[model samples]
Target chain A: MESLLRVEDLNVRYKSYRGELKVLDDVSFEVKVREKVGLIGESGCGKTTLLKSILRILPPNSIIYKGKIFFKNIEIIKANKNEIFKIRRENIGMIFQDPMSALNPFFKVKDQLYDALRYSVHNIKSQQDLQQMIIKLLKEVALSDSERILESYPFELSGGMRQRVCIALALTRSNDLLLADEPTTNLDVTIQEQILNLLRELVNKRGLSIVLVSHALGMVKEFVDKIYVMYAGQIVETASTDKIFSEPLHPYTKLLLSAVPRLTGRWKAEGLIGRLPDYVNPPPGCRFYMRCQQSNSNCKIKPKLLKLNKDHSVACWLYGDEEH
Target chain B: MKSLIISNETIKFLLKRGGSIIFTLIGLSILIFILARILPGDPARMAAGWTAPDWVIEEMRRKLGLDQPLHIQYIRWLSDVLKGDLGFSIYTKRSVTVDVLQYLPKTLELIFVAELFSITGGILLGILAGAFPYRLPDNVVRVMSYIAISMPAFVWAIILQLMFARIIPLFPAGGQLSSHIVPPPRITGSIFIDSIISGRFDALIDCLWHTILPALSLSFGSMMQNARILRMGMTDIKGKDYMVLSDALGLPLRLKIYKYQFRPASIPAITAMGMSIGADLGNAFLVENVYNWPGFSRYGVTAMLNKDLNAIVAVVLVVGIVYAIANFIVDLIILSLDPRIRRMSRSV
Candidate 1:
């Protein structure tokens, strides 16, 4: 499989008055060409941070201590200004969680879309050409009434409509990969399904890849081909979506699956016990060891992600025989 | 040409704003009139002179209608003001309207030049400081603005006069033009404009040369205030979601700052700039005294000192009107800058 985006040993930390919060601790992730990869994690698990790091868009105070994020063979972290800009404009596009804030309130939908288009498409001949290009982009996002949508500001649109516009903005100039950071987190349940479906359709139709960072297990199960379960700034497990659901290895992944409410039979949605480890002074071991019922004396040292089955990996003392 | 066609919403906004301004001016007039009446050193007494006998003082008081009931006096003054009669200034010994008309243009010209500098200098400094916050430029502007804002315009006027006028002798010390240059014919009543239109470049140069110290003194404080406000606004805007997205999209730094960041960040600064005009006019009096510029603010201070009731009221009213007009224009500018405000205007 051809890898479209690969992040290796990415350690990101945010500087605060207290100390450096190790947000992304030695995390490695990858997405293949035309693949839908879902990154599932709880709130403050650094799923969004991972996506931001991939695009090198993290805040000024955040330091990428050790990481190499390659988007289509271009090293994003160390790329020069112009090179990074070209990659962002032509290769990768990002869709933020809140569509309301993602779109600049002052600009009309048309202007924002046109502005993005203008950067990528230099020879955008005339006003009519630009107008037609925008109309086409709007149509691709399933937005009818292109004229009215173009004329209206972000505030004027509904949540779903704004999300649609955001998606359209992301798809400008034929981007190869879409980084959707909890794109449906702020939408209604029904709207969430619609947006997810729209995204899947767009990705498939364009032969484009996507890395969807989300907290909802059910949403990820329905949308992505593979899943990477993140717990406290580390990818604890990775497997085929169905395999993770059927035979989850990591204890945290097991707890997460058990927590999902069932529609039939005895609906016992067991809540996981314990809070996330404080990143400022994270335990030097499997981050989930505190909450893991299976923690032993061996759980004190950090566990590297070790493969136990074909196309399945888990970072746990129980899975790996190598003791270090 | 198309911009001249005001939308119905704008017309409604203007009418609503205009109506409120009139009410505010009326309220201001009543307040000023009452304050003027209660002030020490009676205007009638001032007009009559200390050597005048008891009967003459009484006659002066009667003639000036000082003995009339307060409300009657207010009504009389209001009616006369409505009829374009601002009464007479005992200090200037001229019609209050005439004195204001003569002095106001000079004051306005000074303010106009000062404002030009303040707006441009302030916004430029703001952009510079905001773009590189906490860096060398930002620190320099921060320290400079703090110092400038701490000092009043008059203090700056004295410092500037001493530096440029006396010690360096780069510019003239005081007044409108050099004594040798005969005054240009008052076409627009503004010496700068009159001199230019009448093809007297030498007089125009002299007028401008005399203006620099006073204008710099008047502008420094307000310009610093504008810079601080806009810098804060721009810094706050830097962390917005759109700004992050713009960075994610790798939009050019200049494009993001000018196109995306500037408009939203400029709102607070624009509001401050508008309100600063009123403060500037008030401060201009002290500055005028220091620079010896013959402007309306000087007349206003003299009117207050001599208890020139009519002149004081007229000056206060004019200042209020100018302030209100400035705010109205600012409201319009804000509306245009922010589409959200435009939407709000419709609901209003």
Candidate 2:
């Protein structure tokens, strides 16, 4: 399958008062055409940073040490401002964590969506066409009262409604790839399920690729085809969603799976012990060495991500001798 | 239908705001009346010279209604004020209301021109400072505004007069216009407007030339304050999540700043503008006095010094009304600009 997006050896650092914090260290991943990928990690593990780095939207103090991000054969890392803008407008759409803050408070829903449409899609000809398109998009998001929703400000809407509007906005220009950075983090469980289902339906119907970043392990399990387990700014494991759940290779992945509370009486939940390594002065070798129950003397040397099977890979000394 | 709905909303807002403003003005009128009466010098005694006999003073007090009980005096004053009778000035013997009207236009013209410059120039400088915070332009504006804010309007008036009028000789030193130029017919009483009505270009030029120094001096502090407030607001808005979203959507820089950022950020700054206007009116006393411009501030100051009760109360009432109205307008602008406020108000 042709990859829609590929990131290679991406290292991102942030200048802070203490020191240079290594946020994304040699991160490598890929999203194939129409594929749904999930990046799962604990808080402060640089999952959101990876998504931001792809869009080149990191804060001013952030420094990209070494990386190559290719989107549809275009090297996005080397792209100029105009090219980046065009790429963001035409190729990629993003749904932020907080829907309330994402939409401007001062603007009506219609005006905000109109601005998004104006910048992202080039084919809009007139005001009437624009309105029609907006109404149609709202309908796609299952917003039946499109006129009222469009006319009202974002503050007037419930959290679920606002999230739906945000979804509609992301799908406005028919973007090829949608980057959802914890889209359901600020939502209730019921709304989270609804949003996840909506995203699944949109991806299936539109044949759009998605990279969903989430901290919740169980939430993205059914929606995503592939899962990349991240720890301390590194992709510790990558596999088909079924394989990651059934026979997780990395210790961190295993720890995470064990931590998920089970309803059945047999399996006991075990929380992962130890803290995330301080990015300012991370360990010389394996970042998870302090917490990994399987860590050995060999972990002092960094282990490369080795393919165990056609659909499974792990970055651990335990899988070091595995064949690609 | 939309226009009808909007007008309905506007009317509701106006009625609510007007009720509060009227209440404030009434409270202000009473306060000013009490304060004016409690002033040091006796108005009746002052009206009569120092050598006047007790009978003369007593007769003068009777004529001015000063001998009446405080409540009767207050009631009489309030009733007369409600009827648009401001009474007569103790020193000049001119009707207080007419005197205020005659001198009011000069002060209004000065304030109008100053505020026009202040609002436009302040917002522009603020946008520049905010957009490029910590950059050279921002640094320059910060320094300049600091200087402007630190120096009082009177100090600015003196320095401006010295530099522009004395050394450069660019503008007139003082007064409304050149003494030699025959005054224009007093249609609105404001020299700027009256000169234009009378089609006297020379007089208009002279009026504007004389106004430049005083107006600039009067507005300097207010303009600086406005710039600082807006700059702080812009900086705050810049960090907002919507700003990032706007950028992510690939919206143009100008649209992001002006349409999205400016309106939300400007609420505090715009509200501050009303207070700035009131402060400028107060400062006009010093500015007008320094420049020898015949304005309400000058009249008010003279009345205060001479303990002219009627004139003092009249001037205070006008200033209070103007301040209250300015606040009301600012509230309306805020309601229009902010949807959150509108929603809150609507729900209430």
Candidate 3:
């Protein structure tokens, strides 16, 4: 399958009062057409920043220090804000975590959707066309009583209803790629399951190249084709979902899998031992060295990514040692 | 059913949170009484003289109803106050209602002009400033607002009078109309309104021209406040996920500000706007007096200096009532605009 979106060796930084905080350091990932890829990480692991950087939505102060994000065949890193905005609205659709807050508070749903249509649609005829497009989009999202939902404000709708409205609006132009940032994490368990199922259906139906970011890896496990486990602003492991979940390579992935509670049986799983290492004054060699169980001179010497199997890769000395 | 719901909500609000303003009124009234009592000059002595005999003082005091116990006096004043009789001003020998009515229009005219610039102009400037936050317009507004907010209205009025009125010769330093212009029957209590009503374009022109300096003086500060508030609100709002969502959705600039930022952000700012307005009115002491404008703020300053109890009380109450009403109207607006606040008030 052809790669629909590719992020090559991306590094992002935030200039704060303290210092230049390295948020995303040398992170590379890809999404193929009709492929569902889940980029999983804890909070402050730069998942949202990474997604936003791809969308070119960071505020004026933030700096994408190095690397390029290619959408289709074009490099967006050198693109101006107006150029980026034009591409993002028409070709790339994004959904935020809090659906209710993520939709404009004051505007009616139809108005918001119409605005989206105006940006996405190259040629427009009349008000009737806009209205028709809005109604059709609302129906597409599986919202009941399209007209009613269209007229209502964000405050009027329930959480799940609002999320669907957002999704419906996002899917109005039927874009190629969707960047979902922990879309189901804020929702209740049942609602979370429904949203995940909906996303899975969307991937299957729309042929969207989705880069789903989440801390809750379990939610995206069944849906995503591939998984990238990130730790301390770098991808520690990348594999097919089955390979990664069944037999993870990285020590961090092992810890992550062990941390998740099982649904069926009693599993005495100890959570990851320590907190994330500070990014500003990060440890000299390996960022995750302090927390790793296997501490050695080789471990102190930072290990780069190595491919073990056809579909799996791990950035650990154990893999490097085993390979040699 | 909705009417009942509204009235029930109003009743609950009045019974609960409304008590605070009334409590404020009572507390402020007591402070007024004490301030009057503790004042070195006695009403009788000041009205008469030191040599006025004890019998004369006693009789004069009795006639003025100053012999009653403080609490009883306060009760009579408060209750009669509820009946809308604010008592007669001893110095002016005029009913407080009539006195207030006489001066109310002038104060309101000044307020109207001030509000014109402050509310509408401020909103425009604020929207502009917010749209281009940290940009040239944004930075200009930031500095200008700081200046306007920091400098009192009186300072602006004086400086504007000195600059535009004196040097340029476009507008008068003071008064609502030109001295040569004889206003017809003061039907509307506002020169501009009366001019429009009478089909006098020249009068309207003259009135508006004369009002320029004071209104500009008043509005610059207010505009600064409005701009600052809007900028803060816009900055805060831009931080939200929804703004980015709106960006991804590709909403227009004007629609974003008008629909999204203005109402939600403005509701909070308008609530606090009453104090600025009331202060503008009250602080018009120097502006009114300097301009030789016959607004009640001038009367209030004289009353304060002369220790005129009735005049002082009347002025205080008028200022209080203006503040109270402004705040009430703001709340009403907030309740309509944001159902969240209304629901919170009802639930609480």
Give TM per candidate: 0.97, 0.93, 0.90
Predicted structure with the largest lDDT when compared to the true one? 1
Output the number of the DockQ-best candidate.
1
Which scores higher on lDDT, 2 or 3? Answer: 2
Give one digit per residue, the lDDT tens place, for model 3 in A1-324.
998889988989898888888878888888888888999877788888888888887876689999988888879998876767777767888888899699876567776777778877446689888877777666666676987887677878888888888788678544788888888877877888888778778867888888888877677787788998888888888999999889987788888888878776767767888888877777765677889887567876666767887889888887767652
Question: What lDDT does the true structure give each of the candidates?
Answer: 0.89, 0.88, 0.77
Candidate 2 structure quality by residue, lDDT tens digits, B1-348: 231245556677778889988998889888888888886778899999789999999999999999888879889988988898999898778899899889999999999889987898889999999887889988999999989999999999999999999999888889988989999998888898888988999999988888889999998888988998999999899878788877777788899999898988899899899888888998999999899989989999998888999998899889988898889889877877777766656622
Ten-residue stretch with the least lDDT total in model 3 chain A = A135-144
RMSD of each: 1.8, 2.6, 3.4
- The single-chain TM-score for chain B of candidate 1 is 0.96
Docking quality level of the chain pair in candidate 3: medium
Score candidate 3 by TM-score against the native.
0.90
What does the TM-score come to for chain B in model 2? 0.95
> Would candidate 2 be rated incorrect, acceptable, medium or high by CAPRI criteria?
medium
Off by over 4 Å in 3: A122-132, A145-148, A295-302, A320-324, B1-38, B49-56, B71-85, B342-348
Q: Please tell me which model should have the higher DockQ, number 2 or number 3.
A: 2
The C-alpha stretches of model 2 lying farther than 4 A from their native spots are A266-269, A272-274, A293-303, A321-324, B1-10, B346-348
Candidate numbers sorted by TM-score from highest down: 1, 2, 3
User: 1 or 2, which is superior by DockQ?
Assistant: 1
Q: What TM-score does chain B get in every candidate?
A: 0.96, 0.95, 0.88
DockQ category of candidate 1? medium
